[model samples]
Target chain A: MKATILYEGKHQWTVFGRDPDKPEKIIDTNQYLVSTPSRALLIDPGGIEIFSSMLAATLHHVSVDQITDLFASHQDPDIISSLGLWDQVLPNARLHSPWLWESFIRHFGLNNIEYVPLPDDGGTIDLGDLSLQLVPAHYLHSSGNFNIYDPQAKILFSGDVGAALEADGAPMFVDDFDEHIPKMKMFHQRWMPSNRAKNDWVSRVRRLDVDILAPQHGRLYRGADVKRFLDWFEALEVGVGV
Target chain B: MARIKDERLAEGEVLVSVTVIAAELSEVMKIAKEISIGAKNAKAIAARAGDKARGFQPITNFIDDMARHTLTMVRQIDQEALSVSRICSQEIRTNDAKRRMHDVIRRVEHPSLLKSFQGVVTDIDARLIALRREFDKRLDHLAELLDSINSDMRAATAISSSCRVEASRAEEFREGLGVVADNLEQAVEVIKKHVKECSSRLQHAQRLKQAIYKK
Candidate 1:
């Protein structure tokens, strides 16, 4: 139940999961928390299986009342199936997600929450003083997905865009980018149906001043590795399944 | 009867039962606090009554020390309640995970996904039994704490009765110290009553805890 702080002071960001409470058979997921003094947001809060562990972990950082918003990149269970439990805790909290997933994600339970739908082109989530930008990331894997960008922190929460499926009890960050290719190659090729979407996303992110490229699954890409990830993804072929 | 579909213990029942036990323990804390106050008052009365209450002086210190011990034990019991709450919450999670396996088994069509689901369910079943065993061990620890508190009260009672008898030797001074001994006896009786009641309530909570170990 440790929330490892990525950035402290001013606007803070933390990465949670990869602990004993998370079972071995289940795929590893990285849950993010970005907070200022008055407001906080939970990114891809994870499935029902780890809800208590997540809540207990988050409480160590901030109380339930401080959580102002929840961000779901798209409607995937590993992404946000704990919405039902979250709804119980943060009944008045706003859920920020793509408009395409408004109806589909309701199946994860949205009775009390105010669903703030993001446009197809993506939009900004205002946390009072600090504003978070949602970068459009359609068909990287999910048909209508988006990525969270914190300009001040220079971190891009790339959703499933630069994801890798490391085995359970694996490293939190990429130690060897080239060696990690075999882990992510087949997953991307089969999951990302359109080669056009993959290239478009890679090209768009290259223009942004990103210091950290974080994803929902597997290790983060930091410093020069961010550029390395773009180069690899741009050259790789996806959706052929072969 | 078709075995009553939801025979499994509900989480809310465990929560409410724990809440009641915590409240009963609070009563014991309150009585311990009163006993401390009585000891302070008796010590003052002992000094004024002079040699007639000479034997009573040491016994007042005993009462004060016992009261302090009781308060410390109650704090430990509060910790026990917290441990029970944590274990109960874990049980709820195990139950939820088990139910989810059944859902996955029903809906997932892919052979790989279905096989994975089966593995998860098997893992969760083992986890549920382990959680119950852990819960039982915590309850046993809680029972030991209650027994320790009872032992402290009995020692305090033996000291208290000796002081009650000392109040009879005052002769001319007996007229004034009579009220003091009566107040001390009443405080002792109050402590005994609440401690006995709280011990029983804790045992009831422990039984309810035992009932929840069902598969």
Candidate 2:
């Protein structure tokens, strides 16, 4: 229901979430929008219910016409179900999503907007001034998953990779990493499917120079807390649902 | 009312639109059948009033013929509306199938299957558009038919007033026939009033269709 600018510069990074008004049974999602002067790319633009809220929130930061691209990390109602709604307003906008889920996500109603598929290996997305890397985080939770890494800002929009299922109105960033482990433990263990894939994603992301590890749900990990999350997640026995 | 405000109803909007139009057509069809029955009753009443009610006979017969024609047009519209509903339900079913097989479809490297999916989607869209245009044209035609029926009802009402005056000459023999002529006039007016209401609804539906699909 609100858009908070996490990073501000010529290229601004805004997080649209932390809704106290979100319905009881729905999972709260963090929709990340990276805005440039001429173009903007929205990552994981939430679902059908929060569409009006998302559009209203984004309008506070950038005009609806300014959003030139969209990225859906994977196909889940919570992640990208708003694709159908987006088709009406942003008819000219291009969708940067995993190629695997093109036909699947189309069932969510994607007739107007063009789909620019992200290869299985992942790739880079170009805004007018800045370009973000779409790194493959396959099987982190969804089979064809990705994490958007903004090298200039050192922020990794990690999709649901480090997501914690905390209550609504939770803090935007974790101050105490140890205290936050309980909120994320079950989500990572249960929702995340493969241990091999988890370790591979963690190891690969550890190599990145990340200042902020922003997940689609719960609070983000900032600076020192980013390393704390990686270290804790590395040893955590994930893929328990497997 | 607003032009595709929910945006999420993008393709699914066709289903909502068609359902609303079909329901309106059904209501109109029901009334058309009632009007037909009213005309049949009027014809029987006119036969009892022999020479005195002879003037009422031709007006009642015209009403009867118009009722039949109206019913035929209504039935035609209803069938087309039913087809739209059938198409919508079928699309919903096929879309569900596609969603379930998405992961399976990805695993299997069959280009033909993906092409077939695209083909199906395109065909459905085309069919929906054609059906909508047909509904729009029929709605216009129905409105025109209702106007003609209203005009005919007015003429019958005027003629019935004169017949009532003529029958009043033989108070003993044709007094009963005056009442029959009044009943026949009332039946025509009832049909005309209903047809006008139905015509107004059709106009509203046309406006709604424009808001949903037109740029």
List TM-score (chain A only) for every prediction: 0.97, 0.98
lDDT (0 to 1) per candidate: 0.77, 0.73
Question: What is the docking quality class of candidate 2?
Answer: incorrect
List pairs with backbone clashes in candidate 2: none
Name the candidate that leads on TM-score.
Answer: 2
lDDT of 1 by residue, B1-215 (tens): 11222424545566555556566778778878987888888788888877878987887888888889988988888788778777777677557756644544444334443432344456668867888888778777777877788788678767656765776776665644566556656655775676576566556655555554432
Question: Candidate 1: deviation at residue B196, Å?
Answer: 49
lDDT per residue for candidate 2 within A148-193, as digits (tens), equals: 9998999999998789998778878898888898999999999988
Flag regions of model 2 displaced more than 4 Å: B1-135, B138-215
The alpha-carbon lDDT assigned to residue B167 of candidate 1 equals 68
* Candidate No. with top lDDT: 1
Cα interface RMSD of each candidate: 12.8, 16.1
What lDDT tens digits, residue by residue, belong to model 1 across residues A86-184? 765566899999999899999887767899999999889899988988999999889889999988989999988778888766777788889988888
What TM-score do all the candidates reach, one by one?
0.55, 0.60
